[model samples]
Structures are given as C-alpha cells and as structure tokens.
Target: MTPETGKTSIPIPERTRPPRAARRGAIAIRFRPGPAAIAAAALVCLLIGLLYLALQIRTIFSDQLKQEYAGLVLEAVERAESARNQVGIWQQLPDATEARAAGYRHARTELAHRLASLAALVNASPSAAPRLSPASFTADADLRDTDAVLGTVSAWWRAQRDADSADVRLRIAHVARTLIASAALLFCMLITALGMYAKRNRLLAGQSHEFEWAALHDAMTGLPNRRKLFATLEAAATKLSARSASCKIAVLYIDLDGFKQVNDSLGHRVGDEFLIAVSKRFRESVRKVDVVARIGGDEFAVLVREFSTNAELGEIARRLIACVVQTDLTMGVGMVSASIGIASFPDSVDDYHRLVAAADEAMYRVKRNGKNSYAFADRAN
Candidate 1:
C-alpha cells in the first residue's frame, strides 16, 4: 500500500513529552478509572457509615449533658429548701429572726445564680455536650438514710439529682466506647479503599495494553497483514545483516487453489468457514521463527529465517504443499491445494523490490508448471 492510504504512516505527537496540563488531566481521569457503579456505591456506603457513627455519638453526649445540667439545677433547689427549713427552725428560737433572715436571703441569691448557670448549660448542651463534665455532689445524714421518713422525704429532691448524675456518667462512657468502635471501622474502610484502588489501576492498565494490541492485529486470524509484515521484515533484515550470520531467509508465496469455487458453489457463509480452516493450517505449517501474512485474496506469505541451504527451503515448500493438500475443505471437494514459491535473501537481491519480484516470478513458474507444485527463482539465470 502507498503512503496516501494513511495506514502505514504513523503521525508523531506534536510534543514528544505530553503537555503538563494533559498529564495532570490524564492522572485525574485515570485515578478514578474504577467501575462507576461500584465506586459510587462504595462512596455512598462510606458516607452513611460515618454519619451513623457521628449521630450515635451525638445522641449519647447530648443526653449526658442534659442529665448533668438537670442534676445541678435539682441540687440547687434542694439546698434552697434546706436553708428555708433552717430559717423556720431559727425563728422558733427567741431573738434570732434577723440573723436567720439574712442567711436565708444570701442562700436565695446564690441559689438564683446557680439556677441561671444550669439554664445556660442545658441551653448549650446540643453544641457543648462533647466537652461538658458531670456534676459534683456532697453527702449528708438526710441523704444517707431513706428509713427516716421525714428526713428521707426532705432529701428526696437531692436523691433525684444524684440519680441524674449517675445517668449522665453512664451516657458519657457509652459515647467514649462507641467513638473507639467507630475509629476501628474507619480504619477498615480506609484499608478497603486502598486495596480497591490498586486492583482498579492494574485492571485499567491491562485493558489499555490489550486495546493497543488489538488496534494493529487482525481479528479474524492472529497473523499480521501486509503492512505489519513489511515493517517486521525491514526490522528483521537489519538485525540479521548486523550479526553477519550465515543465514538465508526465504519467503513462501502461497495461493489457495479452488477457494473461489468453494465460495461460489456452497454460499459465502460456508466459504467463511473454509477460509478460517485455511488460516489455521497456514499457522501450523510454519516454524516459530517465521512471519506469516495474508497479503491478498487467496494469497498468503511466510518469511522463513536462518536457512543455510536450498534443500531446507525445498523441504519447507514441500511441507506447505502437503499441509494444504491433506486439509479437508468440507465443501465436498476432491482435494484442496496451494502453489508455493521460495525466494532466498542476499542470494535473491539486496533490496525489498528485487526480493519480492524474484518471489513473484517463482510463483508464476509454479502456476505454469502445473497446480499444487513449488518453484524457486535463481537470480544468476
């Protein structure tokens, strides 16, 4: 094919080094190369888990601070009532009314201040619970005994405050325990994210590599085409020349006989199967070192390397003829066959044109001699 077809010529990128901006964009895009559905689900789950943990902690601390503030308020009310009782007891004594009244006034003022503080604490509990502490308590005879009915009944108020304080402490401990559990879960989620990222990156890399290979390779048959064949031969010839190896490379030109007849007689549908069968046999006939290509309609070529004598080329050509003849076309034909032509490198020519021309000339000789035969060209003749 000529360069005008735009198949053989590859365009070089404007910048050998990709632009910095492009590199950054590619990294950003590649970073999220994970499956969209799976990534979205994982992200949603992570957010929900974190929110659940936060709400649990909030509920625990909120209840704790509320109970603590309520206890403080109850304690202040109990102290106020206790002071009023003392005032009444002092009033019963002669000449102590004024002194007891002043003490009662002071106690009332302190109690008012404590009540204000408790109001502020409860009001701020929603926001400040994370930092608030439980209330401090004092013990007395009335608070210690419940059997003293009058004594216990008077102290029942303080008992309520103590119970509230206990509730507050219990909630705080529950919050702390839950926070520890949440931290462990967060660590596990982070580990899972890391492993998933690595696995996704590897998968994307492999897919990218496979995509590149598929771009240049034929889908029907694994063999290269004429364009790839030419490129490979050029590279191989350079390497072989440098080594100065006593090697002769030969090209086997193959044309499938009665291929068109099979297509015409048994529909193109069955013909496709026949072609696939032919491609398989071609692959089996060549050695690992050989490069094979489907150059045209019903025509294939094989580049055999490191042959020391004409006898080796003749033997290979004979094997190829036998391989095609032995293959069952399944189209109810007598026998399938291919005429092969052998052309050697260096001895044939120094340039690509001369080498290909020699091979083509040999192929025509096979056709002229009779079908299902082989021929080799001699440059000296």
Candidate 2:
C-alpha cells in the first residue's frame, strides 16, 4: 500500500520472450492441412487401390479363358483316338465282307476328320503351336500307320498346351508388374499435388496475416494506429467495468513540439527518420504492457493499463518528454519536445469513449499555455 494514495498497487510480472525454436514451432502449428486436403488424399489412395483390383480381376478372367481353350483341345484329341480304335477293330475282323469294309472306311473317314479339326485348332493359336515336319502326319498315310501318327499328334498337343499355360502365367506376371508400376507413379503424382496444395494454403495464410497486421499497425513507425488503440481501450474499459477495480487505465495524448518546423526546414526523408527515431524512444520509455501508438501526423498515444496513483502517470509523461528531447538532439533538431495530455478512466470522463477526445482537448490546453509540458484533462481549464 502506498502511504500517499492509501491504495494497493498490484505488481505486474514481466513476460519473458520465448526461445527462437519455440516461436518457430508456434508458427508451424498454424499451417496444418485442412479437411479438404486430407479427404482428397484419401480419395486418391482409394482410386489407386481400385485400379489395382480391377487389373487383377482382368488377369484372372484371361486365365479362365486359357483353361477353357486347353480343355477344348484335349476333348478333340480324345475323340480322334476313339475313332482310330474303331477303325483298327473293323480291320481286325476275319471276313472281308462288304459291311465290315464299309464300317472300316466309315471309321477311317471319322478319324481323318477329327485329326483335321485338331490340327486346325492348334494352328489357329500361333503363340502355342510349334512348327512340325511335313512327314510327321499326312492325309494319304496308310490306315495301318494311324497309331504312330496319332501318337505324334497327341505328343505335340500336350507339349503345346504346356507351353501355352506357361506363357499365360508369364503374361499375367508382366501385367501385375506393369499395374504396380503405374499405381506407384499415380501415387507419386497425387503426393505432389497434395504438397502443392499445402504450400498454397501456407502462402495464403501468410498473406492474410500480413493484411491483418497492416490494418492495425502504422507502416512507417511500426506502431499501433488509431484503430488498434481504440480497440485496446475498449477492451480495457470492458475489463474495468466487469471487475470494478481500483487500478485505473490512462491515455497519454502526445503531440510533438516543433515537428512542423522540422518537416518544413528538412526534407520529408529526414522528417520520416525523425519520426521513426522518436517512436523507438517512446516505445522504450514505457512498461512492456503499455502500448505506444502513432495515431496520426505528429500525434501519438500511450496507454497505461494498470496504475495505482496519479504520480505514476506523471512519471510516464516525464519519461516520454525526456525520450523525445534526447532523440531530437541526435537528429540536429534540439528544440523538439513533447506536449502530453493525461486522461484516465472513471476520473476525467464517465465513459471510455470520451477518453481520447478529452485527452485531445487537454493537449490543446497545453499548447495554449506553453509547449513542452503535461496537463490533466480534468484540470485543463
């Protein structure tokens, strides 16, 4: 408790600056992929899986067709063998009767027709059929020589069928490998697309942050502007009204003395530099929680959020004046100083909305009475 004011002053703890790595982590946390990006990635994966499944199903159907073709070849070979057996049985009969002869001729014709059909089927499949010698089977061969010919044809069909089965398996494997490679390529493309999308989102987010910062802050001095100052005051007022605390919020409306002369005597570049230098000094003169804002030309405002006595506000005003005087010397403008007007919530005005106006009116009073001084809004008259 202060002996002079009889009010308790709550000490505000100093906020420590976070480490560089921790700040970077905070920035990284803000640019995560949204729901749309995740959903698109999932859909791409599903498409890749479905394409692989469809390719595999097609290979299975091809294998089924191959099996059916092999079965048909086998059935034709068996029918030819049965006809050859009947021809042999007819020729083995002892009587040379017309009926027996006719039966033998009929069996021979059937066997020849079946052999021709089997040869035609085998020849149709160029991938599986092997080149056979002309002497291997002939249409004019003797009826008694049918067994050797049938054996040769049977052996060739079996070999061809096995070769075709092996080729089908090889083809299926090639198709599977091709499908896998295609899927991998597609997956890579999708991943690239997702990365590009994420990068675009991050770029847009950074632009939005820039626009927001520009809206509330001055471009020249990098201080909060009038809009930002008003917003902060409104928030502080709401807090004060809710808590009904004894600690008060104050606005120090400051106008630079002899600033117009400097702008007229020196170039605008020098004037801009002068403003920047003084703004830095003003920022350094206050507590970490206090906000220093450049509201307009040659005018700035400092907000003191928590203070116990009027004496503390007076001290801040003195520091601001001294900082301006010191900065002006380095810039070769020795005559420059600050005219500050002090106003407080629940002290000068009933509403926080009038705080800045009241402070502005008080600053004019300082100008009228003599520059380079501070005065209170309530005592301006």
Each candidate's TM vs. the true structure? 0.55, 0.72
lDDT (CA) for every model shown?
Answer: 0.65, 0.82
Predicted candidate 2 versus true structure: per-residue lDDT over 182-285, tens digit per residue? 67766776777678778889999999999999999999999999999999999988888887568689999999999988888887788899999999999999
**What would the C-alpha RMSD of candidate 2 be, to one decimal place?**
19.0
Output the worst ten-in-a-row residue range by lDDT, candidate 1: 132-141
Question: Between which residue pairs do clashes occur in model 1?
Answer: none
Query: What residue runs in model 2 are displaced by over 4 Å at the alpha carbon?
Result: 1-67, 82-141, 379-381
For residues 240-332, could you state the per-residue lDDT of candidate 1 as single tens digits? 788775866778888877778777876777666666676787788778878878776677788886788888888888877766666643445
